[model samples]
Target chain A: MPFEEKFHLRIPGPTPVPLRVQHAMNRPMIGHRSAECSRLVQKCSQRLQSVFGTRENVLIIAGSGTSALEAAVANTVAPGEEAVVVVTGAFGDRFAKIADRFGARVHRLDIPWGEACSPDALKSFLLSRPRVKAVFLTHCETSTGVLNPVRDLAQIVREHSDALVIVDGVSSVGGVPCEMDAWGIDIFVTGSQKALMLPPGLAFVAVGPRARKVIRQAEAPRFYLDLQAYQEQLEKETTPFTPAIAHLFGLEAALDMLDEEGLENVFARHRLMMEMTRAGIRALGLPLLAEDAVASPTVTAVRGTETIDATALQKELRRIGVVVASGQQHLKGKIFRIGHMGYCDPLDVLTLLSATETALHRLGKPVRWGAAVAAAEEVWSRV
Target chain B: MPFEEKFHLRIPGPTPVPLRVQHAMNRPMIGHRSAECSRLVQKCSQRLQSVFGTRENVLIIAGSGTSALEAAVANTVAPGEEAVVVVTGAFGDRFAKIADRFGARVHRLDIPWGEACSPDALKSFLLSRPRVKAVFLTHCETSTGVLNPVRDLAQIVREHSDALVIVDGVSSVGGVPCEMDAWGIDIFVTGSQKALMLPPGLAFVAVGPRARKVIRQAEAPRFYLDLQAYQEQLEKETTPFTPAIAHLFGLEAALDMLDEEGLENVFARHRLMMEMTRAGIRALGLPLLAEDAVASPTVTAVRGTETIDATALQKELRRIGVVVASGQQHLKGKIFRIGHMGYCDPLDVLTLLSATETALHRLGKPVRWGAAVAAAEEVWSRV
Candidate 1:
């Protein structure tokens, strides 16, 4: 009686949690210190470690992925130190702000919102700021659907200095390949909602041995976001604080689904969805926000013409039970994003595109009647 | 096959999340800026106001309840600001550490573990430091199962100085009556995993007008924990940063469950569980951690004889499909805690008592056979 409608999530995150995952959360709450809870934590951590591409400690925090990002900055970059941040979109700039707040001398290598950061530009920035102790980059910027080459940037950082390479993989990890250990990524952070197919409230950070060494030498006063303390307590199979147990239960279930699909297949599926979505958007005569080569496989951002308000179109899509997200801040009016990350399929994309064509028509924007859906259906039929 | 075992949670916090609540998390993922997500933010805020007992702005954070505590200290009592903290158990010590981390000139009013902080002591501390800008206290210390007299403490804080009254109601909110507006509480925080009968990860902090004004005047280098920023963004019905969407979904479900039961009935049910648990412990000649009057209705901490290692007994309970928590840190070998909050019933108490008796017997500790269960049944019959 409480749930009158079964809403299908077509948006980027808070993706439709599978029934099995929901049932996972309904498990009896065990004492956090109990052996059962610890075993779950341990197993969960291992699964996360595999996704983050690290053998080091991967800690789960009771908050959104941003909390994990904040913890990484607080623990790695100390006061009075310098951090070179490659800013591509809202999330990239967020790291700059967080690093600055922690007293880091932040040097921002700013780029256009929809464009990806150039690896050469990053190399130049690293050379200019040799004293920088850290480099922050977003692997996949959710705001504009641009995927930055973190592996290339990591190589640049390694050649330039001993600065730790930290990647905000919030929307990318499960959607694509992330080889943390092989790529020499020191600190990688992500959220549960995006590619993990779980709810928010759980964020993960895997700290490499090099990053752990930096944390030991750093001098920033931290209590709750202290990764070292969290890891120390975690080694004993306990959290320094009480964890969100239900979210973890859901995460375990989400992981089971991922395991069955296989990480490689999951990545390939996302790529397939990405190509289908892009083809559908192109068929509608719309401009893609990012260049195809650097476009993210998780989400696609389409540039809207002057006559159409992306915000209004988003609302129109919602009215028909198809929800799409608009751009953030300065990019709000220029672009509308469609996410096809975790738990999404070709049919879901077709539904979104069909509803989108209808919404654009209602907004008096010119569009070929059924072109978008036709293009999407072509991809779906093949699959 | 994914769900090999079906579990029904009867633990204190992280209680069995209702099916409706679990389903709520399955809502379509939307961009944080989508109209639907904003409506969710607005509706959830209003619902949270009712639970927090204030019309003030409630900010939701992704972390354990401790993260909210850190935010309270980091946001309100800026560096070098004078503050007083009342310590009774594990959570209380965490408050002190959080204050210390932020460079607050801290003053502590300590009550022995498992005991309640006295209003007189708090009053005296306030008198000693008239310049204290805030006073931190916990309404319920789940670690030792002690519930402090918040109304009395609030009255004392009012008479002593203008210091903001910040109460941690993490484990108390729905299980106890917390009149934040009536008591002039400036900042009140609680987690979903406690009496709210939801999972962890999402923590809510209600900031009154007074607290908001204080935030404007305070100076703390905070980005992820900038509650002031959350307040501003929440006006638009969204978080300043990405939120744990699924956890919020689960919480909305939890709020509905509480509303159906009514707060008064929720409190009454908890009280009954406490009485049943306490009577059983008393009948077994086991001592309770806190004084009878100040004992928390959420959890009952029973002092165990030295021969019975609390941790070992707990492990044994888990081996038999029953789980209970041991005291934290120094209290580890001293007491065993039984949680009766959230979804727990009299039958749960009976099972725990029976398990405890069996565990104690195996550990060479003397126990009157079946006495604790008889005592619990008698008390439950009266209820």
Candidate 2:
């Protein structure tokens, strides 16, 4: 059998899509320039505003999440302009690297792997470098499972400098409570595959007025990701180029599901899953990479013991029909991650903990059978 | 009812996807880093090579066709380098504009709207400018429905100068005969929605040795559409960023269908459709935008008479449960297009021509009923 039909996917992004969204992909193609297509695009853009928690329209691009991040950077900071990027993990480093590629003079503020960036440090940096044009932040870093304090960091940037606060909410947005306007975020970028319960194709970015002003004046070299062109086309309820029509269909269905469930309830469910998973891991005598206060609601990263190899654990779980993500880049084989972001419930968390317990026991590690699942169930029942 | 369920998509791109490919997209999401996902990606890359007519693997990006075009320019031409772009229509002008955005000193070789670029003109230009780093050509101009002689143009570039010949086969590749290795084309880019019988999210590019050499040394700013990172990740049978996994499933099914029918038969089918469409238009006393000798096999552009407005004709056709594309940019309301590529067949051509006749008659234009369909059926029966 194909792995897609049998394996339980628990990767951070590219999360398991719901059946309704998958079925939505079967909708036939439409003429993109037709009036019907324009109406469909217009409706999708309006619905996306609610999820983004912004009054402004979100710019949708037919690309991966990285392209959206690049667009946010390319549209705001011109070449030789200064920007501060807080690097807490691999994805934070990616944000900084993208800015660097666009000829921005990036100032890397490095935080430890499993820790979030301090807002006071950012304030001091902004106070010293008042000429910085933008401050890049990652709401949730998938590599270390750390949820940075974006609201506090954005507030500090607003108080100390005129820099735009750009947030990479790729792994967090729909799962966590990210109020873009309330947080003073000038540019917020997210992917469709995470808590959106869709496949990995379309990316969304909500640009505020300050970022729009910078976009008009920025001399960045861009064509496919030009925000001004997208803005102009948005008025006509279409994109400048052919978009992913099937993905847009799926987005409509997914957004309907999100709206039906209520955004606050969805966030609460994610928070419950995170607590249950962490409780289960602790009961299994495993240490989480991120501290409790900064742990991400989307994914949980657990550090491996001396006897446990992360890749081996992943493969062992795969044999038992569960799929999880391993550490990325420098942390490979040292940590493992379990994602419970989209379309996940209490029962799903119990299954993941049960599978981990079995895999650890089969690998000759000292694991108490049923302890992890029982602990998760206790947290679940209370929630 | 939604237009997706009933509309006959006759646009130049975002073409009609086959039922099998659409069904394939319903497959459940798998972990992108899993072994199964790796196998799927490797198989896709190999099958794409057969369609691209290249010995090397094709680079697949999770973006629109324009993103693939940007990658071609960003990888080969550095800032301050000289390049030549052949502009015959909107997409051609887009290619030149992207190079200019990347700071390349672009030499625009402007051809007439409805005419193909002559190889002799390109040869003379190349001889005069020996320092030209790259030459961009559009294989099929979807705007004017003209097909350029890319093989001959690449041969001239190889003989006269050391410039790399890059071809945009966006609307042509699978429906037309474009042998990348045999023609000495350095880079060939295409989209999934046109002839690949899939949705519009994925873009494919087949790179030759000469272009790879230049890409290694090119200093153009890029991160998401970076070819070097893609090349490195291709070794691991994966992409640098998350790809459109649902499209990959659809692509596998579509490629299987193409292989079952054979590529030669696919090209022959497109040719037959083109002949039938042209014969039908001529029988209805409609002039074609492109001359017969240079007409494209994928799409047909027809000039509208003063009695008939192109957009109104398109809207009238839509009311009768068919959808056709009107001319783009300055040609809007002057000409209309009919796309008969990918999953289209002889019967589809007959239906399109019949609808055109009905739309023209309803608009009070003098058109003979059944004459156009009979002309198309004559060509179809002969085929």
| Top candidate (DockQ) | 2
Question: Model 1, which residues run further than 4 Å from truth?
Answer: A1-8, A363-369, A374-383, B1-12, B26-31, B306-316, B354-370, B377-383
Compute each candidate's TM-score over C-alphas. Answer: 0.93, 0.98
Candidate 1 clashes between residue pairs 3 or more apart in a chain or in different chains: A9-B28, A13-B29, A28-B9, A62-B63, A63-B62, A63-B63, A244-B200
Candidate 2 TM-score restricted to chain A: 0.98
Give me the runs in candidate 2 sitting further than 4 Å from their true place. A1-4, B1-4
lDDT of 2 at A164: 94
DockQ by candidate, in order: 0.60, 0.85
Question: Which ten-residue region of model 1 chain B has the weakest summed lDDT?
Answer: B1-10
C-alpha RMSD (angstroms) for model 2: 1.5
lDDT of 1 by residue, B219-303 (tens): 6777778888889889988997778777777778888888898988888888888888888778767788888889998988878
Residue-level error in angstroms, candidate 2, position A92: 0.2
The per-residue C-alpha lDDT of model 2 at residue B154 equals 91
* Candidate 2 lDDT by residue in tens digits, A83-149: 9999999999999999999899999999989999989988887788878999999999989999999
- Candidate 2 residue B186 Cα shift, in angstroms, is 0.5
